[model samples]
Target: MFLITDEQLDALLYDLATLYGYDFSGYSRPMLHRRFNRMFRLKEFSGFEDFRRAISNKPELLNWLVAEITVPVTEMFRDPEFFKVLREMVLPAVANAPLIRIWHAGCSTGEEAYSMAILLKELDLLHKSILYATDINPEVLKKAAAGVYPQNILEKYAENYYAAGGNQSFNDYYTSSYDLVKLNEQLKKKIVFSTHNLVTDASFNHFNLIICRNVIIYFNQQLQNRVLNLFDASLEQQGYLALGTKETLQFTSVNQQYQKPFPKEKIWQKI
Candidate 1:
C-alpha cells in the first residue's frame, strides 16, 4: 500500500496537469485519492515519485492515467425512472420539433445515447433528432461510437429497457454474435460521438435537451458550479436538463436559472 501526504498528493496532481495536460485538481479529494491509490497499487509503483517518473518516461501512459481518473461505469436506460419521466414529459414537449438536438454529456460507451435513440424512434421523433454523445475520454468515445457491448450484460440492458418504458422487444435493437452485442445500425446513425472535457472544454453548440447524469459527483463544488454555468450557457431558453438522482442544482448559484418540472425527477428546464 502506498501512502501519500497531502502536499505530495497536490504535487502529483500538479504534475498530471503540467506534464500531461490532464487536470483533476478540482475533483473531490477523497474520490481522487481513492483512484490514485488504486492506480498506484494496480500499476505496482514503488511510490508516487516512481509513478511520476513512469508517466514522464512514457507519455502514452497518460491515456491510461486519464482513464483511471475519469472512470465511467454506465448502463443503458440507467435509473429507469429518469428515462420514464423523459418519455412522459420531456419527449412530448419536443415531439414536434423540426430538428431536435439532444446532447448526452459524459456519455460513456454510448448505452444511454442509444437508449435515447430507441426512445425517440418509438416516439416517431428520431428521424428529425440528432444526438451528440460526448466524453472526456477519447478511448471511451471510440467504444461508444462502435455501438457494441459485452453480450453478458444484455440481460440487464433488456431489463432496464423494459423498465424505462421500451415499446418493443429489446432484442430487436441489437445483434448478438459470440461475446459481443452490436447495436443496430439505425441506432448508431442517430448519434454523433465526440471527445469533450467538461472541465476544460468550452461548449460548442446549443442543445434542446442536455443529459449529464452521474458524472458531476466526482467534481468538487467549485468545479460543479463551473460546469453548471457551462451547461446554462449551452442550453437554449426553456431547454431541458437532466442530472443523476444524486445530483441537484438546488444548492448551486445557478439553481434559480432552472426550474424543476417534477420533484421526483431531476429534470429541469432553463428559465
Candidate 2:
C-alpha cells in the first residue's frame, strides 16, 4: 500500500525521462499511480523512498518496473473478428504490391505480429512481405524474438485462430515441449523485432499496414493524437491502420484524413 501523490508522480516521470531517456509524461497519472503501487506491493517496498532508493542502487530494476508497468493484456488472435477483417480485406488490399511492410506497434510478446505473418504465409504473400514489430519494452522484445509462449494457452489461441478465419490446422504453427511452444522458424524469419517507444520515437519508415492494438489506453488525448499523427505520417497513401477493439481514430486531428472501410472492425484506411 504505497501510494504516490500527484507531485511524486510528476517527479518520478521526470527522473525516468531526464535520467533514463524513457518518456512516460504523456501517460495517464491515475494509471501510472495504479501500476506504480502494484510494483511497490509486488516488490515489497515499504514506501516511495525505499522504492526510489532501490532503483537508484540497482538501475536494472528499472527495466523490471518498465516491463510490469507497460505489459499489455494480450493473446494470440485476441480479437478474432478484427483479425478476420485483416485476413479478408486489409491484407489483400496491400498484397498486390511487390513488397509489403507492416508495422505492429507495441507488439508485446509478438503473438499478433506472428499471427499476421502466419496469415501472410497462408495467403502466399509472405515471400513479398516483411513484418516490423516494435515495442517500447526491450524485455518483451527479447521474449518475442524467441517466439516461445506458455503451452497452457495453446487451446485458447487455437480457438482464436480458427475463429479468425484461419483455414489450416493451427497446430502447424508451433511445436510443443513441456509447458512451452515455439512458433515455426519460417514465421520468425520474415519478422524484424525492435524497440521503438511511441512517446519519444519518430516515424522510421512508411508502411503499407500498421497494426497497433490495445496500446493507446495508457495515454492522454494529446499523446494519443500525437501517436495517431505519427502513424498517419508513417503509413502510405491509403494504407491500413488497425487499433484495439475499444480504440479509435475518431475526434483526433487525423480522424478526418482516414476512412473506415470495415465499419464493424477497427480498421481504417488513410486518405
Candidate 3:
C-alpha cells in the first residue's frame, strides 16, 4: 500500500490550498487518503512531493484534482421518499411566501436543482422562486448549467420522478436526442448554478431552505460544525435544512439551534 506520511500530507495540502484555494484539509483522513492514492496512481507520481509539485505547476491539474476529490455522484430525485416528505409536509409551510430563495448546497450536477424546479412548477411556485445551486467543482457546475444529462439514465430518473409524487408525466420535462437528454428551457430559467466552497467561502445570501445532502459526511467533526454554523447563519428564521440520510445535526454544535421537522426524513427547522 502507498503511504503518505503526516508531514507529506500536510505539506501537500498546504501547497495545494495556497496554489489552488481548494481546501481538502478538513476532509476525513481516510477519504482524503483514498483520493490521494487514486490521484497518485492515475498521475503515476513517485511520491506526495512529486504530486504536489505537478499540481502546483499545472493549474488545470488542480481542477482535475478537485473533480476527483469531490466525487460528483448525483441523480435526479435521488431520494424519492425525501422529496415525498417535502411535498407533503415541509412545502406547505413556505407555500404562501411571496418570494422564496432555495439553496442547494453541494448540488453536484443540478439534478436536485432541476428536480426542485419541477416540484415548484407543479405547485405553481416556480415563477416566484429562485433556486441557487452551488458546488466547489467548476466542471460539474458547467454541466449543471447546461442542463443536459445522459439519455440512458432517463428511465431510472422517470421511475424516481414518479415515485417522488410527481403530478404529471415525467417525460414532459426533457427532450431526449441521440445520447443526451436536455432539460426544458423553462425549468432551467429558475436555476442559478455557481461555484461555492463550503469550507473556505463565506455565506453569500440568506435562504429560506437549504438542501446540502450527502456532503458533510466527508468532513471531520470540526469542519462539520463549522459548516453547520454557516448554514445556520445563512438560513432565515424557521427556515429548512435538509441533510443526507447518513448525516445528522444530533451531537453537533448546532443541534439545539435547529429542531428536526421530520426526524425520519432528516429535515430540520431553525429555531
Best by TM-score: 2
Better of 1 and 3 by lDDT: 3
Candidate 2 Cα deviation (angstroms), residue 30:
1.2
lDDT of 3 by residue, 1-271 (tens): 5777677778878877887787889999888877777788877887766887888888788778787778888999999999988777777788887888999999988999999999889888898999999999988999999999999999999999889998799989999899999999999998999999999999999988999999999999999999999999999998999999899999999899888867578899998
Give candidate 3's error at residue 37 in angstroms.
1.0
Alpha-carbon shift of residue 110 in model 3 (angstroms): 0.9
Instruction: Give residue 68's lDDT in candidate 2 (0 to 100).
Output: 66
- Assess the local accuracy of residue 90 in candidate 1 as a C-alpha lDDT between 0 and 100: 94
lDDT for residue 125 in candidate 3, whole number 0-100: 85
Q: Candidate 1 at 101: error in angstroms?
A: 0.6
> Candidate 2, residue 241: CA error in Å?
0.6
lDDT of 2 by residue, 164-207 (tens): 99999999999999999999999999999999999988999999
TM-score-superior candidate, 1 or 2: 2
- Candidate 1 lDDT by residue in tens digits, 1-271: 5666688779888888887677888999998788777777888987778987887687567777777777778999988888888888898887776799999999988889999999999998999999999998888899999998999999998899889888798899999899998999998998999988899999889889999998898899999999999999999888999998799998997998889888899889998
lDDT minimum window of 10 residues, candidate 3: 1-10
Q: All candidates' TM-scores?
A: 0.95, 0.96, 0.96
How good is model 3 by TM-score?
0.96
How high is the lDDT of residue 77 in model 1?
90
